[model samples]
Target: MAAYVGRGVHGQTVRLLGTRVLAGELREGDTIDLGALSTELDLSLTAIREAIKVLAAKGLVDSRQKKGTFVRPRAQWNLLDPDVVSWQVAAGAADTFFRDLAELRAAIEPAAARLAAQRRTDEDVVVLRAAIDRIAASVRGTAEEETAADLAWHRAMLAATHNEMFTRTDVFFAAGLSERDRLVHGAVHDDPVPSHSAVTEAVAAGDPGAAEAAMRALLDKAETDLRRATAMNRRAHDDHERGSTA
Candidate 1:
């Protein structure tokens, strides 16, 4: 489907640039000067019109008979919509994206571990043991195999808890598991599961405190891994930038 650019496209381009420049400061009943907006963006009126139409459909802006366009309230924003995230990133509003993802982990992971400890079945343990064994066997092999085993191990770990949330989150992360796999996969020597296994065993044995502590250790490892991955990405990005300039 073709996307609308705003009134003859000029309006759309003008409006898009206006909204981004004044994204956070929008208020109802605030009249925008179409001429001034065009001058500021250095774009044609046709382009601005097209940009406005897109933003209007997105509910970020409203156009009235004569009141011009105004920003919508925050409550009306569709935050979880994928397009919204993409727009924010394009607009340079995602500085804390990864940090927020980790914050959600701190909120949800420990409880997931504790529940797995208390609810794990004997069969679940056996399955998890097999997954860990697969991971160990994949050493010095293909990264794809290591990633599959890592994802399987996480699913097995979540199985110990029987909590839907853990499993649901795992599903989301598992789909993107390869986001880290190519970098960290097959790089194992010491097992990542000793701490994870302790949590599962404690859960199966009905030990709450030990289960929680063990899960914490497993999560701590994750945080460390996440940091390492992020640092690597930054270094890569910097190298790319330098190479481009050179």
Candidate 2:
């Protein structure tokens, strides 16, 4: 159901795949074939047209006469667009697209964490600590409460990193972070307090390495849980396919 939700346009599926595509390197003025993509995704030309138009709004695809739609340079893509990220997430032909994103998070968040630790001010520490405490408080609160606090904590981390690029992207990350936990992390069964607190303490203490490692630990645990869920889903999908064929 989840995988299919990201299906292609024009009778194809819609997905909420996020992050991986926009982060890539794009050259200046790359031409793309709407016709080809339509055939590949088994969507109609109309569907492809509408989809590309949306991409164009995001500065991802530019359409001109005597030439079909073309991919804009990487700098132009609207990384913050929720639909764009979801589409990117759905565009993958292999399961690895998501796994790679998870793995990439594991690699990058740590470095970002380290930076935040070294650069964070006292106020930043207070904000992050407060967010962490809120997560703890919310654990016993309603589902919506926990979700909001968790995202707040993540945004604080992104801000503490003090990287404009990282900070700017927080809305996107915060929107998808918990969903990633739910889909990839087996419903976030493990408590997030311990996971997030380590990050806060390290940053508060100005321990760059520890901050990075702590952030990595949280993501690594997520990756582990995500892998489990993905494997389980794949096996179930394969069995379904086999049974249908049989």
Candidate 3:
């Protein structure tokens, strides 16, 4: 997941506070002492205020004359924001993030595949094929490479739909998907190449029903892989805890 922060001190301040809030170091409804933060971080009041404004825009914090600046409830956060999603994953919430991402993909990708099959141009087919090739190649490469290829493949799928709204949704969920891909790619899972190839072939053949079904199958496998990965992570953590206590 990409870190989107302002340049220099402003960006640093926002990242510091945002991570604290997302990581639960600063709980919801907890008031922020901007003056103390400014002193602590050695940033000017203007820089701290600017960071607060940025966070407020993302629904992370709010201020009033009497109440002062405070972290908002999680329910009020713009969870769909990529930066927020990135921070959450960074805060070790990858399991929850992956589960949410799978649910969202279940809602979006199958429909997108169907639309892509119906609406895709020859150029779209080329892009989709190239993306699949990248995915295949990256499977033997580094995890980050595989994650990037996976992201490109999904983006290509969405773009092929030729629907503005569907394409725009990519920005909101890309971070979560990036984290998901990294985890799944690094875990013990089935070969993603064949599943991805199936969807691309269906899209290229302009078979809407086949495309949707293939994408659904792909998502089913993805969810399974995610669950497996999460379970493995939990077991590893439990083992570490036991060893530490021993």
Among the numbered candidates, top lDDT falls to 3
TM-score, prediction 1: 0.55
Model 2, 53-135: lDDT tens digits are 55567667688888766777767777446555455544442254455566656656788889999999999999998998898
Worst 10 residues of 1 by lDDT: 1-10
Over 1-246, each residue of candidate 3 has an lDDT whose tens digit, in order, gives 345758887776788788889999999999999999989998888989999998899999999999999999999998877778767877777767777778888899999999999999999999989998898889888888998899999999999999999998787678788777776776765788899999999999999999999999998888888889878878998999999999
For candidate 3, the 10 contiguous residues with the lowest summed lDDT are 1-10
lDDT of each: 0.62, 0.67, 0.87
Backbone atom clashes (below 3 Å) for every candidate = 29, 11, 0
Q: What is the TM-score of each candidate against the true structure?
A: 0.55, 0.61, 0.81
lDDT score, candidate 2, position 38? 73
**Regions of model 1 farther than 4 Å from truth:** 1-95, 164-166, 169-172, 175-191
- The lDDT, on a scale of 0 to 1, for candidate 3 is 0.87
Query: How much is 84 displaced in model 3, in angstroms?
Result: 1.7
lDDT of 3 at 244: 100
Best by TM-score: 3
Candidate 1 residues 73-128, lDDT tens each? Answer: 65665443334444444454544544554566556667776777778888987887
